[model samples]
Target: MSLRSYFLSSAILMGAAGIIGASGPLQAKAHAAEVSGQPQPLPLPPALPTARDVSYGGTITLNVNATDLQRHILTMQETIPLPPDVSEKGGDFILLYPMWLPGDHSPTGTLDQLAGLKISAGGKQIPWVRDTVTVSAFHVQVPKGTHQLDVSYQLLTPVSPKEGRVVMTDAMVNVQWSAVSLYPAGYFTRQIQFKPQVVFPAGWSYGTALRSDGAQSGHTVTFKTVSFNTLVDSPIFSGKYFKKFDLTQDDKVPVTLNVMADRPEDLAATDDQIKAHRELVHQANLLFGSHHYDHYDFLLALTDKLGGIGLEHHQSSENSGPRGYFTKWDKTFAARDLLAHEFTHSWNGKYRRPADLWAANFNTPQRGSGLWVYEGQTQYWGYVLAARAGLMTAPQVEDALAEVAAVYDGRQGRMWRPLIDTTNDPVIAQRAPQSWRSWSRSEDYYSEGQLIWLDADTLIRKLSDNKKSLNDFADTFFATNNGSFVTSTYQFDDVVKALNAVQPYDWATFLHQRVQDIRDHAPLDGFSRTGARLTFTEKPSDYIESYSTLRHVTDFLFSLGFAVGKKGVISEVLWGSPAWQAGITRDQELVAVNGEVYDADDLKDAITAAKAKSAAPITLLLRDGDSFHTVSITYHGGLRYPHLEGKMDGLGAILSPLSGKISVTDHKE
Candidate 1:
């Protein structure tokens, strides 16, 4: 019989035997009546107070002591005055620590480092509770007639980089106010007033945008009163060794370059070096056609001890350089653009911000959908300004751009992910290391965004017969409210409008197609329009040599599809490349190359030798954890490093000096 007939007969027999019957529902219901343990989540507590635009009655006084270098601890005492209604009724009070920090674009507040928190009012201690949700908030019951509360806390700085950013060391300290203090939650940060005082280590010099109140008592200095927003925007860098240079010229606004170093020798900047920095300011002014801050400060730290940073603010920026920034300026060409990058942020990111990124308080989340313009354009201008100011040669800048182009051209992730989606990487990944970076695509908006702006600039130049470029857009978009530090926010439409004003084109469609669409190839039309092309050579460019020296890595991505760091450890592997196809992965140590102990040069020689014959394959012995494996990669492409060729007049015009007469100097050692 067929299988269906046999099943039907069995069902009939079972029904007759009472095995299947109409009482099935009752039996199932009886089984379902048994207990099954399950739990439901409890309702969350009330939300924190929303920030308002009203005034916060009185000034908040904050005092910080940062002398404990041995323990890497910074102690802070803050006094927050309550509003009239809160003081009279004596109900619930809330204090919020900054979470969504600017520049970070993520909730990176170091709440884990905050310890020894104490709150007192009217000479009596008050019990405080951390909110179940939004743990950055602290809730307390305020007693009637209590006008203010005294809060004390300690910021336990990381002793090593593995824990967090090392903000303090025996030689220097970086004091970010947001990391050390808390503020009332009900008012806008700009509506609250703050008076800050810091006690630095004795004999240490510091630089900050905060104007001194001229009230210094030995080691402590008091700063003039400022809004809470400004207090958080201004940070301090203090060190045992320091140097200051005046970059102000032909303008009422004062721009100073304050540098601190790990040693006194590292602070030695030559006259030419200082001149280049001054030219940076000049070129920036010429490009934007205006200045925002009344005065600007560049707080630079030349140290290997303190954690590296390149954060931007309205009137100042925090930057870190190699210990050999000035002492070995020729070799440190790779780091020369840091100051220019951060300085450009003063006009692009600080004065002109994305509408979605602006928030009333620091705890509110910031949307980074517009970072492509905020950071990407700034990055493009940074390289241009650096070359214009003689910080780097035109050739070096072209080489760097070639490297950027090659990287995006080889990015396998572009096939699946669009450039616009990578803007969310800051929050989605929090900069965590990924096993397949080439496939996952981490923060491509910065470099790829640079390419997009370059494409726009070249297109504008072409359309306007070299009469207009992104320079016009900068002058038109960011030059508003001259000398005013008030932030002006913009939306996607605003960007398109500004570009249209510069040179009329189908900018909306152009941007949408490039940013929102997934494609197999990178945006390379900019190079072609600029009379240059990305090409590969058997040898690396000077920029690549310097980059490799600084990073201590071998660049075999184009040939071997992998980059090996020091001690024969693999740092990166391109997805779907020959090495990847051979099962080679990152963090694996290359034990041998063709039966010889692994060496960078030896591997390169092996690759070169394998190119001569069709039957030969590059043999590699790799170690992953305790296991060992042998793999053969059939890549015959000899050593290939990206370089730019062809006429560079279009790029030269874009990178030409816009300010004063500046001579281009060769950056080669």
Candidate 2:
């Protein structure tokens, strides 16, 4: 049967009870009743990637004064050499700041941060003009016989205490290279060579994939020759409080954890915790079967002060989290896959990149068409790798899996938009403010991709009689011959080719239907095929609890289909939910609940009151934009959270073996 038919059949088996929950008292539910639920490493790659590096033959000096980070500014002076071709190309030269950055996959270059923009050749200041149509490009006419130009500017660092600010504390800084430099506009980015040098605050140490020339003169440091690709790909994480731990002892792949935090105490990780992380490398190596880089760096920033962000690179990733990220192990483990996921990108997004995303120049806007496979597949293996390494418990992974299933199932936007189209969200949304996130689904590919891959894995197991699986597909697709810095681009057909090589099917059509076509239900056939099913629970999921605690919000997302902020404000009105039908929306504050003053407690009391009383419409007085209005919502579902249940049938036989198969008991904490 097709993926659609499979879900309809499975939905009956899974959601067989009814479309909506009954208005009864909240109670305990049994764990997946379908079937008995069973349930890295170092490498150092070379200094330079094997890409075309056109030598302009000069160093760009970037001076940063991070000592007083409260000012949120980084001053810089970039000296660029005018290539001989400048004269031949008519001197109307354009210097482009990084616009379309890789990994970010957006035109994220902060043009507004640029100040004191001045260019000089032969000690004479040259007039520069900003392009009308192109925002990032700067036009400057070169003087006669001038082989070099000096450019000076300043950058305003972002300060976001909770959001993972790019600029952390006064002592630590995450240097995004693209933010500080300007490149020539004519050649391919790989063909552009740079001798990068930076001058920072005194006494601050740094860690980056960029090979420092050991030519540190006081606070200033210079790096060896490398292509612009490597220069930008290598992010610098440096600070006052830093700790280095080698994850691998003596392996072909060298892995190291370079952690920086606001406090020294936060850098502490137990021996067991370190061992589990070390096993992460081993597990990944075992899964992929081939290594890409010679060495890897986990640039972890542990701080409550810094804005938390996770962006993947070939050799390194910016894994920023709370102060208790490592200190509070189990609680923070839900997001443990942040490091693993970004690491997987080294293979998926860096080595075997999408054809359209792997552009020639930094200014080229990346066509985010393959984010499903690029980000989606990486997300799948990230959780697997973490679990295999004992970063999370099997039950924790299951809880996390339930969140994915529930997220897709509740994603009412799927009725309007297909999964594939949202791949362009990196450019369009790219972190846009959540206006109507549930109504306008954002990046469903990651969760949906996991579901799709699970289905594919289930299909493979059934076809090959459990002799093969997605692991086989991963081993074939990711691993390359000999460790090299070379990148391989792939198309849609390449994904299907790898899958068919393991087990032949009409995968292209299946994938097209699942990803391109809009459907009412989520791609839950994977659960059914794996001898499992999705079901509802009265309690909140571990994933939900962890996130809710961190964010400090009352999420009745699965229950009433809405989330209330700390100040009795309705943050979102989920699509097709009770609140949506009642005409309740975002920014509306709840003034009263059933004639009582509205607050988190009062809201809960009202919902609980509904459960015990008649499944009556809960009356709520909302403060709309200008006027206050009363909304009556009919929501019988008291408090429902989704979890995966077992089928225990023929498919369950195959699914039970795969559950937590990647996890090793030796590393169990």
Which one wins on TM-score?
A: 1
Question: How high is each candidate's TM-score?
Answer: 0.93, 0.86
Please give the CA lDDT of all the candidate structures: 0.89, 0.76
Which candidate comes out best when scored by lDDT? 1
Off by over 4 Å in 1: 1-37, 660-669
1-669 per-residue lDDT for model 2 (tens digits): 432343356556545343235234321122332245433112221121222345544544454444556776777777777766674453566788888888887887777777888998878998876654576877776755777888888787766543225574776887888887888776677777777777766777778888887898878888887788888899888888888888863444568899998988998899999888887777777677666777889998887666677988888887787777788886787778788898888888998888999887788768978888999888888877777778876667777777888878878898899999888887888787676787688887888887787778778888898788888898888876536577889999999999999899999998999889998888877777766778887777887777676666777777777888767788777888878888778888888988888777677767766775576788889887789889887766677777777753533332232322222211210
Candidate 1 TM-score, C-alpha based: 0.93
Collision count of model 2 = 26
Q: What is the lDDT of candidate 2?
A: 0.76
TM-score, candidate 2, is: 0.86
